[model samples]
Target: MDHDIEKAPSAPPTRRDALRVAAGLLAVGAVPLAAHPAAAYPGDIDVCTGGYDAEYEADLAMAEALFEAEEHRAFAPERPPGRYTLPLRRGFRVSARYGIRGDWLAGHHTGIDLAVPTGTPVYAVSAGVVVLARRSGQYGKAVTVRMRDGHYAVFAHLSRIKVRQGARIRAGARIGSSGATGRATGPHLHLEIRARRGYGSDIDPVRYLARRGAPLL
Candidate 1:
């Protein structure tokens, strides 16, 4: 998440040297042939007047402007929203609802836990591209599908993954099998709905899928 600019070597002090030369001219009351309007000020006044190095300042200004432009360009737009289907057919009973329990060390659960036996077939909830298919940390054997609506549907604690990353899958497509792959007491499917774009909100999966015409037990 760290996004910072790398430091670059600074240019030589051409403006400071020029200002010094200009000051010597005005002190001796001798105007140099190279004297410009900026060097016409009396007694090193350019040093204190903030007009000493016009070119140097201009270069610094341009560099700073370009840096800002690059910074903005580095920030990409948020992903667009897309329609999603239920990852499983004939939803199983909800063993644990989202944000209902405080017993977990992570506080409220961000996803719904569907009670299912080990090796139970789990399908893709919607038409989306498989973004994640791996096993790690607490979400063992996880699969993340990014729908066209920019939302992501995650199925965790899977026993096996049937699809690979970057694969386009349709609704109800077999993506994995449910199991107690992560830290859990029994086999179940951990389902999550994450908002697309920069909105990292975790929505209620039951209510969300129900609105999409998917039955929820």
Candidate 2:
């Protein structure tokens, strides 16, 4: 996912160049962009509706069971305590869920996993103050937001942190980019909605997000 973006040339395209262009577009889910000239690619086949490419889908499945390990902790679960949008845009395909699964979580899986590209933009699920923004141990580069409800939200395995601690941020604000960090086996965002601003006190973020209008499974 880490690539050096280069300026594309406007010269006459070769067959190989055309295929590369088409592939790049498809991988980004923007193949046959309306703004692109139909004849730009070889064979003049105008791709429509962003056709699915097998490689792209497989490469982008949520990172290795959403990067989890056991953490036996107790929770005084509560409702969302507020509204929220999908932590990742375009809805989700949750790779890992809340609660203990003998496979991933030890006692309780605090958050839900939304596997995505390494540099996919991550938005703040709700308005809150950035309380913690640092390289947390197994969580990698993480951000903890103190929501207006006093409950907390965690965004982990980030490639870059976009906001600073103490910053008052609103829902949908760009907070960070997803990545394969900490104990992750692949690139994805580890999202947790907690009863407070720490581990060992987590709730079902899936149900919480759903109640808030974003139903993800």
TM-score leader: 2
Candidate 1 residue lDDT tens string, 78-116: 233334456666446566667653433323566777877
Error of 1 at 190 (Å): 0.4
Clash count for candidate 1 is: 10
What Cα-based lDDT does every candidate model obtain? Answer: 0.58, 0.57
- Tens digit of per-residue lDDT, candidate 2, span 1-217: 1112233444544545544544553455432212211112223121111112233222211111111101111122223435576667754445555663332222445576676778889988887666567675567787877666667788888889999765767778899998866656567787878774323457888787777787666
**Estimated TM-score per prediction?**
0.58, 0.59
Cα-lDDT of candidate 1: 0.58
Taking every candidate in turn, the Cα RMSD to the unseen true structure, in Å, is 25.3, 20.5
Error of 2 at 32 (Å): 54
